[model samples]
Every structure is written in C-alpha cells, then in structure tokens.
Target: MRIHLSSVFVDDQEKALRFYTDVLGFVKKNEVPIGEHRWLTVVSPEDPDGTELLLEPDVHPAVKPYTTALVEDGIPAAAFAVDDVHAEFERLRGHGVRFTQEPLEIGPITTAVLDDTCGNLIQIVHTA
Candidate 1:
C-alpha cells in the first residue's frame, strides 16, 4: 500500500493556505466547510493526483500541547521534498519565511526547517 493523505495542524487555515500556496507553491485541492472550520487540503503542483496534504485545525484539546512541545524542541511537524534545499531555502527566506534551521547537509540529504507561522515547523529536504 502507498500513502494517501498527511496533515499539519494549523492555527489559522486562511493564513496557512496563503503560505502553503502562494509561498510554498502548492495548489489548492479541496475545501469543504465543516461547522466552525473547513476541510482544507492542498496538493503539490508537480503531483496533482498524488498525496494530499490536509491543513488540519489545531482546535482539539490535545493538539496545542503536542504542537507546542514539538516546536519547543525544534522538531518538524512535516517534511516536503524539494529539488534543491538551498534554493528553496533562499526563495522562502526572500518571502520572509522564518527558518528555525538553515539548510544543513547530513550525509546524502540536506534539510532546512521553517516556521509555518500558523503554529508549526515544516521542513524542506533534498537528497543529493
């Protein structure tokens, strides 16, 4: 079996959408209203039919502490693959994205961590 959908807990869905789409270049896939929130999702422009990333709301009681701990410890909530980690890092930094970790090379892979602004740290990685 293969992966289908993964999610990142966000504090504000609209702001998250702008960052994910306008900044990160992912395209909107689905948006359905659900009571006080929406079932929002985005897909990579390169893989429109591939795995979808769900922009989940962190409204649940257990989510805040979990996300907080992850951030406090400098851990990434999710990772997205990019062709060039350095290039992506510079591009994101140009857009004023605050990075917790600059691109670091570890063996065959390179990665950088950036704050999503909506309360999560996301990583971008590339394998050389």
Candidate 2:
C-alpha cells in the first residue's frame, strides 16, 4: 500500500497554517472544527491530490517533552522533499526562517534543517 496522510505536531495551528501555506507553499485541503482544535490539513500545490499533511495540535502532555527532546538533540520533526535543497534553503532563509543546519551534501542527497517557529524543526531534502 502507499502512504496517505502524515502529521506534524504544532504548538499553534494558526501559525503553522500560515507557515506551511504562505511560506512553504502548501495549500489547505481540509479544515473541520473538532472541539477546541480544528482538523486542519495541507497538500502540496504541485500535487494537490497527493498525500495530505495534517497540522495536528500538540496538546497532549507527552508531546511537549517529546518535541523538546527532539529539538535539544537537533533532530527534525518532519522532512519535505524539494526539487533543489540549496535553492529551497535560500528561499526559506530569505523569508527570515531560522535554520539549524545549512544545506549539506551527503552523497547524492542534500538537506537543510529549519525551525518552524511552532516548536518543530523541519527538514528540506533533495536527492540527485
């Protein structure tokens, strides 16, 4: 079977929506109200019908510590594939996005890590 949906725990759904859409260029796919949080999801503009990335709220007690440990260890919460890691890194850096790891080539793959500003480190990757 193929992948369907994936998620990134976010401290603020609204801010994550803005960053994921306005900055990263994803488009909103679904938004349904669910009690205190909304079931929000986004899809790539290039493939709107492809996999959906859910902007899940990190309200669970274990989430904070988990995310905190990941950040402290310089681990990325999620990774997104880009056509050009260097170009994408430049574009994102121009948008004032803070990057923990600059674009580095490791064999045929290149990657860069940036903070989402919503308590998550997101990685952009490309393979040659």
Candidate 3:
C-alpha cells in the first residue's frame, strides 16, 4: 500500500502558503476555492508527484482547542522526513522559524520540533 494525501489544520491559508512554500521550500500542487476557504495543497519539490500536504482551515471550534493542546503539550501535528534533522533545523532557524525542541538524537534517529506559525507544531526527523 502507498500513502496518498495528508493535511495540517491552518488558521490562515494564505499565510500558511507563504510559510510552507517560500520558507519551507515546498511547491504548490493544487488550489481550488470553496466558499471563504480553498482546497490548497503542497508537495515536496523533490517529490512533486508524491504525497501532498493539505493546508486545511481550522474553522471548526474543536480544532482550535485540540491543536492548542497539542502545541502546549509539545506534541507535533505532523512529522516530515529530512536527510539531516540538525541541518534542516538550522536552515529553518535562519528563516526565523521558532523551534520548541532542538535536534536530539535518540538511538539512530534525530528529531526537532518547530512552530508551524499558523496553529501547529511540526516535527522534522531523520533516521539512520
């Protein structure tokens, strides 16, 4: 079986687009307007045809509290794979991204958590 699409709850689509694309280097894949929000998604530049990350609107009341709790408790909403967690963390930091956890190695894997700016904490990891 193969994974397809995934989503991240975002407060603002436009701002999230800027951060995810301009800052994180993902490429825009699809965008379709629906009411006040759009069905927006992005894919890694390295794998344009791979899984797409949807930037969904967090308009539902429960989503705010749920995402807030996850952030407050240091839980990541989504984890992205990287070649080197430390290098990715440093690159993100240079772009003014706020990190909650510095790169930490545990066993053969390293991980770091950062604020997604919209309303979630995202993790970057590498496994050797």
Candidate 4:
C-alpha cells in the first residue's frame, strides 16, 4: 500500500494550521470535526493531492513530555523536503519561526530544525 497520511502532534490546532499554511506554505486539505477536536490535515502546494500531514492534538497527558523530549533532543517529528535549505531556513526565520538547529551539512544532505510552536520540532532538508 502507498503511504497516504502522517501526523505530527500539536498543542494548538489553529496555530499549527497557520504555521503550516502561512509560514511553510502548505495547503489546507481537510478539517473535520471529530468529538472534542478536529481532524485537520494539510498538503504541500507542489503535491496538493499527495500525502496529507495531520496536525494531531496532544490531548493525552503523556504527549507533552514525549513531545518536549523529542524537541529537546533534536528529533524531528516530520521532515519536509525543500529545494534550498538555506533559502527555506531564511524564509522561515523571517516569519518568526524559532530554529533550534541552524542549517548544517550532514553528509549528503543539508538540514535545519525549527520549532513548529506546536510542541514539535520539524526538520527541513535539501539534498546535496
């Protein structure tokens, strides 16, 4: 089966949506109300019909600790491939995005980590 969807835990849905769509330039794919929270998802502009990234709520008590540890350890919940890591990093920084790791060369790839402001660290990478 083909990969269709992946999720990144977020503390706030609205804020996460704004960051993903406004800052990162992803397009909103769907938002369906499900009980206490909504099933919100977004897709890259270049792949509007491709895999959707679900902005899952961290309602569970354990989620906060898990998310914090991951971010502090520089483990990204998800990675977005970009054309230029430096340009993308600059663009994101201009939008007030807080980055934990600056752009650095790692073997055959260049990557940077940014705080999604939603209890998660997201990675942006470009192939070298």
Candidate 5:
C-alpha cells in the first residue's frame, strides 16, 4: 500500500487554502462538500498528483481543544520540505507570515517554525 492522503486540522478552510496555495505554494486538489463542512485538500507543487493534505476543519467539538493545544505548545501541524530553509523563511516572512522559531541548524537539517495565522504552526525544513 502507498500513502495517499493525510490531514492537518485548520480553524478556517478558506483562509487555510489561501495560505497553503498563495503563501506556501501548494495547489488545490479537491474540495467536496461533506455535511456542513467540505473535504478540502491540497497537493504539493512538486508532486501535484501525489499525496493529498486534507485541510480538515477543527470545528468538530472533539478536535478544537486538541488542535488548539498543539498550536499553543508550538508543535507544528505539518512540516514541508524546502529547497532552502533560509530563503523559504525569508520569502514567507516577506509575505507577513509570523514565525515562532527562527531557522536554526539541527544536526543534518535546518528548520524553522511559523504561524499559519489559521490556528497552526507549520514547519519548513531543509536537509544539508
């Protein structure tokens, strides 16, 4: 079996979509209405037809607290690999993205954490 889909909880689907597509550079893959919320997902530009990252709504009662806790604790909802951590960080910073942790060398990898402004911290990493 191959990995096809994964999800990251978001407080707002529309805002999350903008951030992922316009800021983080992902492409919209699907958006299907399911009950009150939509089953929204996005795919990486490098792998447009690859794994889908579902932008799951955090409005569900059980998930709100959990998602909020993770964001408060500075744990990223998801990590995205980048060609250059510093450059990507700068690009995001220029776009008004708020970073919680600046890029730092960690062994063989350099990573930075930033606030998506939609209730989650997202990590950007680069392997040296």
Candidate 6:
C-alpha cells in the first residue's frame, strides 16, 4: 500500500541525473546499463531508503505528445513534498530553477510548479 518507485520520462538520462541530483539534491540510488539506455534511479536525500524516482527515457512515439499535452495544459507530472513550500521555492529559484507557478496557498496546502526540462512539469508542495 505504498509507492516503491516512480518515474519521470526524460529526453536524456544523463541530463536528468545531473538535474535530479546536482540541482534538485536527490541522491543516486541505482544505475545499471540496459542496452543503449540504463535503469537509473534517484532518491531524496532526506529519505534515502524511501521511494526511488526512475529516470526513464521517453523514446516511445506516444510519449512526446502525451507529455507535451500535459505541459501545455499546465499539469504536473510528479510532485515532491517539502517542509516549507516558500522556503523550498526560494532555494530552488536561487539555484536557477524556473518555476511556472510560484507558491500559492490553496486551502490547507501550498504548491509551486516547475519545468523538469525533460518534457514534464514537476510540483513541489507543502501543507499548512
């Protein structure tokens, strides 16, 4: 009854790895070569043993349009929880990350959306 792993389709695995790790601060969990691509995954540094985020390649023909539509409609592909949405937003913005939506409160929660640079929008969120 829990998420063991999740994935975000990426155009380039190498670039995604660097962004998810070096920029977003996730830690590499596994990397195994699989033909021309690899089975690469990363985990949040705060939850190393928790769910892993797979960096999957989006080479399938359907993926482009599916992801493109999501982005065009301003829908986020993945959401990561943070302790403070504002602080995390500021920190990430300071790190040169571009956000589509700034932190906005909605009822008891707050969220911000950013482009993953891999054909998806990712949301960072917190609850009040």
Tell me which of candidates 1 and 3 scores higher on TM-score: 1
TM-score for every candidate vs. truth? 0.98, 0.98, 0.98, 0.96, 0.95, 0.97
Give candidate 4's error at residue 80 in angstroms.
0.6
Model 3 agreement with the true structure over 18-58: per-residue lDDT tens digits:
99999999999999999999999999999999999999999
Better of 1 and 5 by TM-score: 1
Clashing pairs in 5: none
lDDT of 1 at 15: 96
lDDT of 1 by residue, 1-128 (tens): 99999999999999999999999999999999999999999999999999999999999999999999999999999999999999999999999999999999999999999999999999999999
Those runs of model 1 whose alpha carbons end farther than 4 Å from true positions after fitting are none
lDDT of 4 at 63: 90
The residue-level lDDT of candidate 4 at 109 comes to 98
Q: Of the candidates shown, which would achieve the greatest lDDT relative to the real structure?
A: 1
Quantify all predictions' global Cα lDDT against the true fold.
Answer: 0.97, 0.96, 0.96, 0.93, 0.92, 0.93
Over 37-59, each residue of candidate 5 has an lDDT whose tens digit, in order, gives 89999999899899999999887
Q: How many backbone clashes does candidate 5 have?
A: 0
Candidate 1 residue-pair clash tally: 0
lDDT of 6 by residue, 32-75 (tens): 99999999999998889999999999988999999899999999
Candidate 4 residues 1-128, lDDT tens each? 98899999999999999989999999999999999899999999899999999999999899999988997788999999999999999999998999999999999899999999988989999997
Better of 2 and 6 by lDDT: 2
Model 3: residue 28 alpha-carbon error in angstroms: 0.5
Clashes of 2: 0
The 10-residue segment of model 4 with minimum total lDDT is: 65-74
Model 4, CA-based lDDT: 0.93
Residue 1, candidate 4: alpha-carbon lDDT: 96
lDDT for residue 62 in candidate 5, whole number 0-100 = 82
